[model samples]
Target chain A: EAGVTQFPSHSVIEKGQTVTLRCDPISGHDNLYWYRRVMGKEIKFLLHFVKESKQDESGMPNNRFLAERTGGTYSTLKVQPAELEDSGVYFCASSREYDLGLSIGAGNTIYFGEGSWLTVV
Target chain B: DQQVKQNSPSLSVQEGRISILNCDYTNSMFDYFLWYKKYPAEGPTFLISISSIKDKNEDGRFTVFLNKSAKHLSLHIVPSQPGDSAVYFCAAGDYTDKLIFGTGTRLQVFP
Candidate 1:
């Protein structure tokens, strides 16, 4: 089975510009998520999508960031008027949603993509 | 504040020896923990995981130990190989299924 795949492995854009990152999750996976790692910081969750509906988006940084998954397929994260601080490695992950009470080990496992490196200058 | 933390920034181990990585979390609600290994230009891959109900879970050469009381967890790799050198991230999960990760520890294994 192919794992999650991200497009434009590396993106460099000027500050105040708009950039969009894309992610194609594994086939049949209902749970998709977005996360990012800034310099000297741990990877942090951005948002999650379950079949086109957002499950959680509390981690979003600000209003300039937007994520969408239409038809429960691929996902896109758009950053408008990007700032320098937004530069980081953005990762997309997917998992087969199972009962949370069943087995915590494998049931809730999430597979990650290679990540897209975005640099704002 | 960071909920999960891997205090050590890096660790060096000789091949054929054991490599132990440590992690501590501040949140008591975190019931599940996982370890991920990442290589340059690649994404993180799941190494092993352990639930709060159990103290230890072993998989071949990898093992994860969770101490609920201390809010600490660890990953142990036996007979470490050169290929095992990479950045290892410790993550904690709650009922929401969101994995909160640590800053990661870079492990280098020498032959």
Candidate 2:
């Protein structure tokens, strides 16, 4: 009954460092997604995971960003050698089914974490 | 290429009035449209959605209208209340189930 949970509500690191954000989606959710919004831009899709498999990663900003879903229960997004432009809020969402509507979890409500406010200085 | 766009940056309305937020998309592949409401610190929450099969969907005081021909959609809140104030995002779904979102419109319903 818990909503989507993300770790390290806030992160601040010098450029060229590394950071990993974790998301624990609702138990049993088959669909997991990652999205983010840069300082002054609209939120953009990063990728999606379905049962430990990468479904789509077309929106990933660059090779520096990597995502993994071990066992499809939870997910992790890693940014290596982070750059100043990577500063933003990253969110994770999950859905129970691909149905037109309904069947989506409240977690699917896309309940955002307090948001991992990442600031790459 | 921004597929979904929320033209209005912000809208204001008095309590008990009607508030309408608009969104447009340039993509023809979009098959489903949704509206989400978000507070400053939290993540976006699904308010309502309409599929390509339907033109209008309503729940209580919130109604979503979709015009696939024009690639536009709107969220209308009747008798707006102060609690309804928040940033509203319009999203479109493509071939994949991924939700592409607009920049969002901020709504302020004054009491």
Candidate 3:
């Protein structure tokens, strides 16, 4: 099976500019998520989408950041008037809905795409 | 405050030896723990996982041990190979919730 794929593996933009990152998850996966890792820090959750509807967006940092999952297929994360602190690696992950009785190991396992590296100057 | 933490920033191990990475979590609600391996410029790959009900889970060459009472977990790789060298991340989550990750530990294996 093909793994999750992300667009524009690396990007550099001036501060206050806008940038959008795209992610195509593995086929048939309904649970998609967005996470970001600042340099030298742990990867932190941004938001999650269960097929088009957002399940949780509590992790979103601020109003400038927006994420959308259109048609329950792929996802996009956009940062408006990006700040220097917005520079980080953004990762997109997907997993099948969990069937608790089945196998927790693989059922809840999430696969990630090669992250999009963003640098704001 | 960081819920999950890998105290060690890096570890070095000789090939054919055992490599053990440790992690600690402050959240007691976390019931599912996972370990992921990541190479530079790539995303994390799931290595192994253990649920709170069990103390130990072993794969072919990898093992995960969870100590619920202490809120600690560890990953052990036997007979380490050079290819196994990478950054290892520890993650924890509640049932079906988003995972919280630790600052990764970089493991280097030399022959």
Candidate 4:
């Protein structure tokens, strides 16, 4: 089976421009997640999706960033009016829903895509 | 505040030697810990994971030790090879699905 795949491996845009990064998860995976890593910082969670519904978006940085998973398949993260701070690597991951009784590490092993590198100049 | 931290930004090791990477976390609620490796221009790949229920877990040449009391964890690579060179990240998670990651530590193994 193919691992998670992302599009436009690298993107360069001017400040205030909008950029949309796409991710296609492994087949039959229902849980999708987005994370970002700024230079010299840790990878931070952005949001999660279970099928077509947004499960948790508490990690979203601001209102300018938007994420959507349509038809419960692929996901897209769009940043509008992008700032210098928004230039970073955006990673997309997916996993099968965990069984309530199983250990989190074992049941919810997430697979990541080759992140999309966004540079807002 | 950063919940997870990898103090050493980089490490160098000779091939056939042991390479140890350390991590510290502040959140006591984190029960699941994981280690990931990333090459240049690539996303992190899960290496190994350990649950709070155990103090150590090993696979092949890699071993992960978790010290719950100290809120510390370490990854050990035995007989380290040049291919082991990469950036290693430590991550923690509670009951929630989201993972809190640390700033990565770059490891370089030379022959």
Top-lDDT structure, candidate number: 1
Superposed model 1: Cα runs more than 4 Å off? A98-101, A106-108
Q: Which ten contiguous residues of candidate 4 chain B have the minimum total lDDT?
A: B91-100
True contacts kept of 3: 0.53
Q: Which stretches of candidate 2 lie over 4 Å from their true place?
A: A99-112
Docking quality of model 4: it rates as medium
- DockQ, candidate 1, comes to 0.67
Docking quality class, candidate 3 = medium
* Off by more than 4 A, model 4: A99-101, A104-107
- Show model 3 residue runs off by greater than 4 Å: A99-103
Task: Label model 2 with its docking quality class.
Answer: medium
What's the distance in Å from true for residue A15, model 2? 1.2
Model 3 interface RMSD, in angstroms?
Answer: 2.4
lDDT of each: 0.91, 0.85, 0.90, 0.91
TM-score of 1: 0.96
Per-prediction DockQ, in order?
0.67, 0.49, 0.59, 0.57
Best by TM-score: 1
Candidate 3 on B5-63: residue-level lDDT in tens? 99999999999999999999999888788899999989999888887778999999999
The i-RMS of candidate 1 is 1.8
Clashes of 4: 0
Instruction: Give per-model TM-scores.
Output: 0.96, 0.93, 0.96, 0.95
Question: Model 1, range B9-97, lDDT digits (tens) per residue?
Answer: 99999999999999999999887888999998788998888888889999999999988889899999998999999999999887777
